[model samples]
Structures are given as structure tokens and as C-alpha cells.
Target: MQLVLTVLEIVSPVFILALIGFGWVKAGHEYRIEFVTRLAMTLSIPALIFVALVNAKIEPAALTSLLMAATVGFAAVTAVAFVAVKVFKLEIRTYLAPLIFGNTGNLGLPLAYFAFGDEGLSYAVVVFAVMALWSFTFGVYVTAGGGHPGKVIKEPLVGATLLGGLFLWQGWTLPTFAMNTLDLLGQIAIPVMLITLGVAMARLQVNSMGRAVALSLGKVILCAGIAAVVGQWFDLAPVPFAVLVVQLATPVAVTSYMLAEKYGAQAQEVAGLVVASTFLSVIYLPVLLGLLL
Candidate 1:
């Protein structure tokens, strides 16, 4: 009973903020998702990443280890997702990337911060950066069924990610005033992202509940199992290992649905995934956190 409350204490704020966004949208308020998302991804998130990385107290070697673990873990997830789609005779273009790329940024970051503290959030950002890079490159290609994978170069978030890594590696620090300002901007990221997530979900329309439910369940099991295995294989430290598992086990990204819409690859089906997987996460994430805690 005490444990349940502990877990609840950690997880409640995230879901509550999201619920506010969800409720806001359902209440017929104007959200302007595209504008809010643009602000978050381009300005706020990059600032958050830069400040977190530059100010992070983690050792460089530990970051490298976690970085490599995330790289290999993503590769493994991609390979497994591909095989699953092929064996099931599902549409590779539609199912592959969504299965492989989870919502590491929006959901994963805040969860890690709450459950494990600042050190955990620092580690979580490394994994998020890796996943973002891959998702921008290969995830795009898979969804588009053949597009330029080099488009990651044009992303501001990607630039911030690389810049942050460089700072972390070089043991550099910004001036105090500048750092504090960036920290303040960065502070806006998590709560805004949580609310945005709810707003986005409220706007999503799921068309195929059956397939969505099944695939959502499959994603939870496959991602969590694979992350757990790889985290052990790499012998990750306690916080990083739990962060890896939880981040990888996040729900299908709303970006997947947007990609499907853009690429003409069954938008409604991916919407089903976004909805089902997110709904699943409300239950799934807490259980995972309980174990990790």
C-alpha cells in the first residue's frame, strides 16, 4: 500500500498535466497544437537539452556507455520490429517505425525526472537524443518508404543534442547568467510537453481498435523486454538501466501518426496505435516504474 502511494506520488503529476490538456481540448478551447509543438520542439526542448547536458554532473564515461547502450538497443528494437511485421504479414511501412520509435521525449523525460531525480533525467536525455536522431533519419525513411535520411541535419533539436554532447565531453560550462536563463527556458519543457501530449491525443482519431490494441500490447512487451535485456547485457548502472527500460517502453509517438498522414500510409491506423498505446501507458508505465523504484 505504501509502495502504491509512492508510485502514485511520482507518476500522478505527469498524467494530471496531460489530462488538463486533454480536458482543455475537449472543452472546446483553442490549442493550436502545431504552434505549441513547434515552440516546444524548436525552442524549449533544445534549451532544456542544452542546459541539462551542459550542467549534468554525470561522468563522461558513463554517458558514453549509456549512449552506446541506447544506440544498440534502438538497432535491436528496429530489427525485432521488422521481423515481427514480416512474420505477421503486416504493412512494413506503417508498422515498422512506429513499433521501433517510442515517445522518449514527451513522456519519458518527465517520468524519469520524477521517479529518479535530476541525474536520471540527464541520463534520460542521452537516450532521448539518440532516439530523436534515429527517428529523424531512419524512422523517416521507413515511414516514407524511401526518403532522404540526412534530413536530421536540418533539425534544431538535433543540433542542440550534438552541441550538448560536445559540451558534456569537453567539460565546459556557460557563464552563470546565461546558464540560469537557459535553465529557466528549459524549465518550461516537461509540463508543456505533458499538456501537449494530452491535447494531441484528444485530437487524434482512432479507426481500428482491434489491431491497435493488439499492436499496442505487443509494443509494450517487446520494447520493455528488449530494453531490459540490453540494459543487462551492457551492465548499465541502476538509474541509467531503469531509464533505458522506461524510455524504450514509451507509447507510439504522435509523430508516427503525422508521418502516416503525410506519407499516405494509413493515418487512421497509426492514430489507432497512438491512442491505444497511450491508453496502455497509463497502466503500463506505473507498473514499470514500481519495479524500477
Candidate 2:
């Protein structure tokens, strides 16, 4: 009973904020999703990443181990997802990337912050960064057939991650006023993202519920299982291990649907994935958190 409430406390805000966006969109209001997403990705999210990394209290060695774990974990997921795609005779370009890459940014960060506090957020950002790097490069390649990996350098999030890592390594700190301003910008990321998630959910048009559900279930199991095994192999501490599993097990990213649309690889099918996976997360995340806690 106490555990249920604890899990509720952690996840309620996330769902509620998403619900607000869902409701807002349903009420005939307008939301410029592209604009908001651009703003968050280009500005606020980078600030958040930079600030989180710069101020993280984790040791260099622990973070290094976590990085190795995350890299190996994602690689394992990719291999497994590829096999599943081929076995099911699914469209490789349409399904593989989405299965391999979860919604680590939109859903993972806030859950980590709420569930484990600052320390969790710190660890969460590392995993998020790793996923982002992979998603921008290999994930894009798989989805689009060919992509400019060099263009990844121009991404604000990538820049922030690199800069933040430099600062973290050098033991650098920003001035009080500067840090405060960046922190303020970082603070805008979570609520906006949550509401945006809800808005996206309300607007998504699912094409096939059965396939989506089955695929989503497979993705969650594969990702979480691989992450758990990798975390254990790396001897990660409890919180980082949990963070790794949760991040890897997040719902299919909305970006996956967007990428499918952009690449002409069956947008509606990917939309089904985004919606079905997100809905699945609403049930599984809380249950997973209950056990993890």
C-alpha cells in the first residue's frame, strides 16, 4: 500500500501534466507543436542538459562506468530489435529505430527527477545524452536509409553535452548570475515537455492498435531486460541501474513517428506505435517503478 502511494507520488505529476495538454488540445485550443518542440530542443533542453551535467555530483569513474553500460545496453537492444523486425517481416526502416530508441528525453528525465531527486536527474541526463547521440546518428541512419552524421555536430543538445562534459571534467563552475539564468531556462523544459507529450498524444492518429500494442510490449521487454543485464554486468549502483532500465524502457519516442513521416516510411503506422507505446507506459511505468523502489 505504501509502495503504491510512493509510485503514485512519483508518476502522478507526469501524467497530470500530460493530461492537461491532452485536454487543452481537445478543448479546441491551438498548440504549435513544431514551434514548441523547436524551442525546447534548440534552447531550453540544451540549457537543462548543460546545467544538469555541469552541476552533477557524480564521480568521474562512476559516470564512466555508466556511460559504458549505456552504450553496451543500447547496442544489445538494437541487435535484438533488428532480429525481431526481421522475424516479424516488418519494414526495417519503419520499425527498427523506434524499437531500439525509447522516449528517453520527453519521459525519462522528469521521471528520474521526481523518482530519485537531483541525483537521479544527474544520472538520467547521462543516459539521455547517450541515447540522443545514438538516436541522432545510427537511429537516423536506420530510419532514413542515409543521414549526415556530421550534422549531429550542429545540434544544440550535442554541443551542450560536450560543453557540459568538459566543464564537469575540469571542475568548472559558472558565475552565480549566469548559473541562475541557465537554471531558469533549464527549469522550463520539464513541464513544457510533459504538456507537449499530452498534446502530441491527443493529436496522434493510431493506424493499428494490435500491432502497435504487440510491438510496444516487445520493445519494453527487450530494452528493460537488456539494460538490467548490462547494469548488473557493469556493477552499477542501485539508482543508476534503475535509471538505466527506466530510460531504456520508456515509450516509443514521438520523434520516431515524425521521422517516419519525414522519410516516407509509413507515418500512420509509426503513429500507432507512438500512441500504443505511450499508453502502455502509463500502466507499466508505475508498476515498474513500484518494483524498482
Candidate 3:
């Protein structure tokens, strides 16, 4: 059907870019993931967020509604994840954060753009900003037992979100040349992020495949369900509603595995979740997009 092809067209480039990174690593090429991640986070992604919000054509009220809906959806996810962790007697430090926070940045953003175009990117960034804020603050606390709140403000993503929101509120625009330059920098974010995702997956060692698969499946279902309910509850427009579901339903972030490693909370298990969830996304995302479209 035309819908199936539409979903494939939207999803193909994302996975292909990721596969390129995966293949690059398998070919024994050197990729300094940390350096690339720093570049994207510190420069490119911020530019993308700022530019997207500044230029978005949608009304601020709709975006505000989406923002609140995303926050509530995340909160609901955190609550359910906590209950599931307790009921299952899983390790709180390791499983909880991964279950609560999905990969809204790298995977979610590009998918939104492809599926719903620039306006979707605008909506997606709001969700990403919410995720970034929550993950940096509460997610870090969950894994590390405590974290510096001030450090969240220091993040470039946070700065961009705040600055972008300010501009959106005030109807401010940067000079044309500056906007073009930022737009050019912003363009690198998606391809690089997709490739980095593939590279990370290629390098990750998944332990406990069964548990990882189960958790990943559970996460997708729970997140998508919550997002769907929240989007309807908030009366989101069609595009924003669909974008919300996709962003929240993204796989476990590679950052979750890194955090687990840094905090000594079953890093290999977290790695397993990351790998399992990402692979599962390749199958389920297209199907989900088909239904959403």
C-alpha cells in the first residue's frame, strides 16, 4: 500500500545512515565517538534546536501544549517504570533510568523531520528539550544517587532550549547571515547522530539478550501507549500527536549505557538494553509510522 511505502521512505534513510556507521566500524575504521559526540552536542545540535524553534511556523500555543503533554507523558513513564522495577525486583540504578528515558534526540528528531517535515522537527525539538532536561537532572540522580543541578544549566542543549524558547516567545529572529551559518551547522547534526548511533551499536556488547529484548519491548509499548493517551488528552493536532508518539517511543539511548558504565550500575546490562531496543526500533518504528500516518 501507499502507506507502507511512505513509512519505508521516511525510515530508510535513518537506518541507512546508522548502518553506514555500523559498517564503518566493522571495516576497522577509527571513529572517536566521544569527540564526535562532543562536537554534535556542543555545537551542531544546539544550532539545530535554536534554528528550528526560531523558524518554526506553528503557533506557540500548540508547541506549549505539546511541551506540557511530553512532560506529563515522561512523568507517567517514570512512575510506571519505577513500579515495574519494584515489582520485578530489578536493580533500581541500572534498569530504572534506561526504562524511563528513550533515545529522543538522535533517532527521534530525524524520524520526525522525515515523517512530518520541518514543522515536525519543530515539535520534536520541544520533546527532545523536555527529555534532555529530565534525563540530565532526574536520570543522573537515579543512576548516581545524586548529581549537580547546576551542571544541567551548563549543558549547551539546555542553553539552546532556553534561548530558543525565549526567541519563540518574543518573535525574535537572528540576522539573515547568522541564521544561515547556524542552519549550515545544524545540518550536520542528523547524519552524524544517525551514524554515531550505528557506530555505538556496533561497538556495544549486549549481555542477557532475553531480558534486554523483553525490557525493550516493554519500553516501546509503554512509552507509545502513554504518549498516545497524553497526546489525545491534551488535544494535540495530528502532526504534533504523531511526533509525540514517535519521539517518546524511540529506543534506549546510548548515553544510558555510558552513564551506567560511569556509575558502575551494570554497564553490560544497560548496553544490552541499548542494543536490543535499537534493533527492535528498526522493526517496530516502520510499523508504528504506518499506523500513525
Candidate 4:
């Protein structure tokens, strides 16, 4: 009972904030998703990543292990997704990347902070960083049919990650005034992302929900199972282990839908995926937190 309550306490706010956005959209309010997402990605999220890493009391060895585990876990999941797509005769261009890469940023980071506090956020960021790096590079390549490697370094998320790691390694921080400013900017990221997620979901049109649900479920199971295996294999600590699994278990990102639309793939199919998977997460995430706790 207590554990269930704990999980509820952590998850309720996340869903509530999202529901606010959902309600806002339903009420005919004008929420510009692209502008908000652009702002969050370019400014807020990067700031959050930098500030979180700089302030986190994580050990280098643990960070290294989590990074390694995240890298391996994502690669393995991608391979499995590829095999499944082939066997199931699904379109590789539409489904593979969505299945392999979860929404570690918008959902994972905030959930970690709620579930396991700042320590978990620190751990979650490592996994998020890996996902960001992989998705920007390999995911872009897959989605776009071909992408430039140089584009990876040009991403602010990548730059923030690298800079954050450097600051972490050197035990350095910005002056108090600068740090506070960055922290304030970073604070906008989580709420903006959460609200944007809901707004995006509200706007999505699902063409094939049945297939989307089945494959999305498969993704959740495969990703969580694979992350668990990798976490155990790496001997990750309790918080880090839970963070790894939870991050991987998040729904298919909204970016997948946008990418599919932009690349002329099955955009409606990907939209179905984004909606079904996100809807599933509302029920599943709390259960996952219950178990993890």
C-alpha cells in the first residue's frame, strides 16, 4: 500500500501537468508545438543537462558504467527491432527507429527525479545523453535515409552533454549568478516538454492503431527486458539499474512521428505509434514504478 502510494505520488504530477496541456489544446488554446519544442531543445533541455550534470554527485566510474550499459542496450534493441521488422514484414523506414529509441528526455528525466530524486536524475541523464547521441546520429541516418555525421556535433544537446561531462570531470561550476540563471532556464525544460508531449499527442492522427499498439507493446517489453539484462550484466547500482530500465521503457518519442513526416515515410503509422505508445505508458509507467520501487 505504501509503495503504491509512493509511486502514485511520483507519477501523478507528471500526468497532471500533461493533462493540463491536453486540456489546454482541447479548449481551443493555441499551443505552438514546434516553437515550444524548438525552444526546449535549443535552450532549456541543454541547460538542464548541463546544470544537472554539473551539480550531480555522481562518481566517474558509475557514469562510465551507465554510459556503456546504455550504449550496449540501445544497440542490442536496435538489432532486435531490425530482426522483428524483417520477420513481421514491417516497413523498416517507418518502425525500426521508433521501436528502438524511447522518450528518455521528456518523460524519463522528470520521472527519474520524482522516483529517485536527484541521484536518479543524474543517472537518467547518462542514458538520455546516450540516446540523444545515438538518435541524432544513427536514428537521423535511418529516418532520413542518409544523414551527415557532422550534424551530430552541431547539435546543442551534444555540445551540452560534452561540456557537462567536462565540467563534471573537473569538478567545476559556473559562478553563482550564472549558475542560477542557467538553473532557472533549465527549470522550464521539464514542464515544457511534458506539456508539449500532451499537445503533440492531442494533434496526432492515428491511421493504424491496432498494429501500432501491438508493436509499441513489443517495444516496451523488449526495451525494458533488454535494459534490465544489460544493467544486471554491468552490475549497476540499484538506482542506476531502475533508471536504466525506466528510461528504456518510456514510449516512442514524438520526434519519430515528425521525422517520418519529414522523410516521406509512413507518417500516419508513426503517429499511431506515438499515440498508442504514449497512452500505454500512462498505465504502464506507474506499474513499472511500483515494481521498481
Best by lDDT: 3
TM-score of each model, paired residue for residue: 0.98, 0.98, 0.99, 0.98
* Per-candidate local distance difference test: 0.91, 0.92, 0.95, 0.91
lDDT of 4 by residue, 209-241 (tens): 899899889999999999999999999999999
Off by over 4 Å in 3: none
**Model 2 Cα displacement at 290 (Å)?**
1.3
Per-residue CA lDDT of model 1 for 1-293, tens digit only, reads 98899999988999999999999999999998999899999889999988888988999899998999999999999999999999999998788988998999999999999998889889999999899889888887888877776788878778988899899899988999988988998899999999999999999977769989999999989999999999999999999999999999999998998898999898888999999999889998999989987
Best by TM-score: 3
Determine which window of 10 residues in candidate 4 has minimal summed lDDT: 147-156
| Model 2 lDDT per residue over 97-162, tens place | 889888888899999999999889888888998898889899888889997799889999889988
> Model 3: per-residue lDDT, tens digit, 121-238?
9999999999998999899999999977788999998899889988988999999999999999999999999999999999998767999999999999999999999999999999
lDDT at position 10, candidate 3:
99
Q: What is the total number of backbone clashes in candidate 3?
A: 0
Cα TM-score of candidate 2: 0.98
The positional error of residue 117 in candidate 3, measured at the CA in angstroms, is 0.6
lDDT of 1: 0.91
Compute the lDDT of residue 273 as modeled in candidate 1.
92
Q: After superposition, how far is residue 13 of candidate 2 from its true place, in Å?
A: 0.4
Residue pairs whose backbone atoms clash in candidate 3: none
